[model samples]
Target chain A: MKFCSVCSSEVKQRIPHGDNRLRFVCTTCETIHYENPKMVVGCLPEWQDKVLLCKRAIEPQYGKWTLPAGFMENAETTEQGALRETWEEAGARVEISHLFTLYNLPYISQVYLMFRAKLLDLNFSAGEESLEVRLFSEDEIPWDEIAFLTIEKTLRQYFEDRRKGHFEFHIGDVERRVK
Target chain B: MKFCSVCSSEVKQRIPHGDNRLRFVCTTCETIHYENPKMVVGCLPEWQDKVLLCKRAIEPQYGKWTLPAGFMENAETTEQGALRETWEEAGARVEISHLFTLYNLPYISQVYLMFRAKLLDLNFSAGEESLEVRLFSEDEIPWDEIAFLTIEKTLRQYFEDRRKGHFEFHIGDVERRVK
Candidate 1:
């Protein structure tokens, strides 16, 4: 931060009074600014054995297919964020299973959490953010059209684990950029 | 949204020429707008079997103590985000255990994810965002000084679970406010 939040004075990364390492310390307010990344949580809704995917009606990754995901709401858990996003984007009720895949993109400064979810029913319509919403069997997935690399990686890992009957966890950076 | 991102014209929520629920439907552009929330992740780092805590150096709850937390960076996993925050604020490394707590607060439009982390070591110092940092035994926790309600609740639940050896999982704040 260029200015201090407390006193509005110029802030700089300087050594702490008695420490050697650098810190974002404000000379006037004598405080440091904190930096944090944003969170994205969603679900991979499944029915029988097929997975749910949504076609984006918006930009950034328009028309691309993806699992429902969005930032966490103020009063929600990671799972609720996942379920709520699924409902809003896919019009589906989902019961979340175990913690599923976690995709990291350090360069973007964001983390994407996807839980394994069971599709409660097929009742759904185009979500405000979706151009199309449907379930895809393994063979029906539009792998090339997936919106983000993290989603592609997560889905790939999920399928691999399913094939191996292994439910081990996975975490990696599609890019190391901090969001 | 009444206006389409593509056409920049008014859109209708109801299905055109039919009875259906509301959605962001663009007539001219034929595109929908989708908005999603961001995610925030953090960790509960423990040292010598005691949890480490940081006094907030910023507001919303300035001066209150909390487990170190920040939003997920562009491409970090929830676990990575949690671990990063702990290390940055406390100058400590840790081993992340199971995700012991998940809270979704829709009112504020954010989700809080917390993992049980064992402090690999306690050599720590205050980061820029921390006014002070220290390890607290279970009974010595400074309950009222915590920065967020989720932190307090997470600690209480952690202690209880540790007591019962209840390593099983269950989501928190299904109905109550996440904060």
Candidate 2:
């Protein structure tokens, strides 16, 4: 940060008293600006043997397929945020069963929470941020066109567990991809 | 926030186009500052039949007993953050088993993720943010003096699951308590 949000004064990066990490400290107010990882919550909405996916109309992988998820907002539970994102991006409603997958992307400072949800009905369409929304079965999933590593991993796990006739909560990390 | 950290300009709260929530928008640079919930990660260190606890040496719940947890920082996984908090507050190292409990406090916009862990050794002492660090058996826990509701619920669930001989991942919400 170039300036303090509180005092509008210059902010410098330094380790404050009794702290080991460097933080943006204001010159005038001495306020420390701390940044933390954000949570992205969404759902794998199931309909019969298919799952929902949205083609993004926004940047950062525009036009690529992804599960309907976004940065969670304040004053809401993870489940609520997941359902809200589902409705917003896919224009569909689902009943959340349970948390299915959690992937920590430390490279981007984000934690993704994906829930297993049952789609209510087929009356779904694309929202403003989505160019299209559709259902894809296991064999129909466009794996190569998936938008993110976390979403792809979650999808693979879901199908693997489905074959085993049991679903389990999964957790793992997505490290920075070496290019 | 009164001022924008990007340009040191006055900020105003408004609903950005295509966004349903109000955010701090800079008057000069038009930067949208979005705030979201934070994650608090820690471990329930288990040794034999006892779990570790820390007496707070900081504000918010000074002197009250609690599990060793704090706001998660950037560039770290949840498991790493939990282990760091355990070491920092209780001076203990642990082998985390799995995520035991997840609690959402929407009133404060925080999510608590507590993992069940095995204490590596007993060479432990109070850390800077802890007045005392000690272990407590199920019967020895101080119910009324617990610092937060999430910790109390996790502790209770731990003992209950131990009696059942099977532990399950739990999720719940902690609504604002009326005083």
Candidate 3:
């Protein structure tokens, strides 16, 4: 940050007292501007032997198949965020079962929290952020055209856990490879 | 936020196009500064049957005991953030087992991600943000003096799960009452 939002004074990057990392500290108010990782909440909305997927209408892999998800908003639980995202992107209402995957993408300072959910009905359509919305079975999934790695991993684990007859929570890091 | 962090221009609260909530939107730069819930990552550091706790030296609940936790920083996994908070607040090293609790405090726009962890050794003391650091058994816990509701809930769940001979992930909300 070039200027402090609090005082409109020029800020400098420095380690604050008792802190180990450098942060944007205001020159006038001396307030430390801290940036934390944001959570991207979504759900795997499943019906009888099929899961819901949405085609992105926006940039960053537009038109690719993805689970209905988005950056979480304030004053809501993670499950609420997931349900909201699903409804916003796919016009689907789902009952969340449990958190399925927690993927940390440090490269983008974002954490993806995907929950297992039950699709209420088939009354689904493409929302504003989606070009198309549909259901996909195991063999019908667009394996080659998935949107993100986190989605791909969550889907794979879902099928695997279904086969094992036991679902478990997963937490892992997905780092961008240096070129 | 009074000024747009992007352009340093005065911002006004407005609902952006295709969105439902009011956000700080910059008229000059057309930047929508959206605020979201942040994650507080920490762990229940266990050395055998005892768990580590830190007496806060910082404001919110100064001198009261709590688990070592802070805001999850950018470019770090939740587990890494939890471990770092443990090391920084209690000067303890721990190996994380699994995520134990996910508590949503909607009033404050924060999510607590607490994990079950194994303490590495007995060489630990109070860090910069802590007044005192020590281990406590279930019977010796300062139940009435815990710093936050989330911490107390996690500790209570931990002991209950331990007694049941099974540790499971917990997800719930802790709402703040209006005065």
Using DockQ as the measure, which candidate wins?
Answer: 2
Tens-digit per-residue lDDT, A1-179, candidate 1: 35453454566788776444466677776775444466678888878768889999988889999999886554456776688888888888989887676666567666677888898888978888899999888888899899977787778887888899876555555663223
Candidate 1 docking quality: incorrect, acceptable, medium or high: incorrect
lDDT of 1 by residue, B1-179 (tens): 33443444566665543313345666666554333454557888866668889988877788989998876554456787788888777777889887767666555565677888888866788887788999999989988677787778888888887789775444555344344
Chain A TM-score by candidate, in order: 0.83, 0.98, 0.96
Between 2 and 3, whose lDDT is larger?
A: 2
Fnat (0 to 1) per candidate:
0.41, 0.90, 0.73
Top candidate on TM-score is 2
Ranking by lDDT: 2, 3, 1
The DockQ-derived docking category for candidate 2 is high
Give lDDT tens digits, candidate 2, residues A1-179.
89999999999999999899999999999999999999999999999999999999999889999999999999999999999999999999999999999999998899999999999999999999999999999999999889988999999999999999999999999987553
Best by lDDT: 2
DockQ of each: 0.21, 0.92, 0.79
C-alpha lDDT of residue B160 in model 2: 96
Q: Pick out the ten consecutive residues of candidate 2 chain B with the lowest summed lDDT.
A: B170-179
User: For residues B45-124, what per-residue lDDT tens digits would candidate 3 score against the true structure?
Assistant: 99988999999999998999999999999999999899999999999999999899999998888999999999999999
The DockQ ranking, best first, is 2, 3, 1
Chain B alone, model 3: TM-score? 0.97
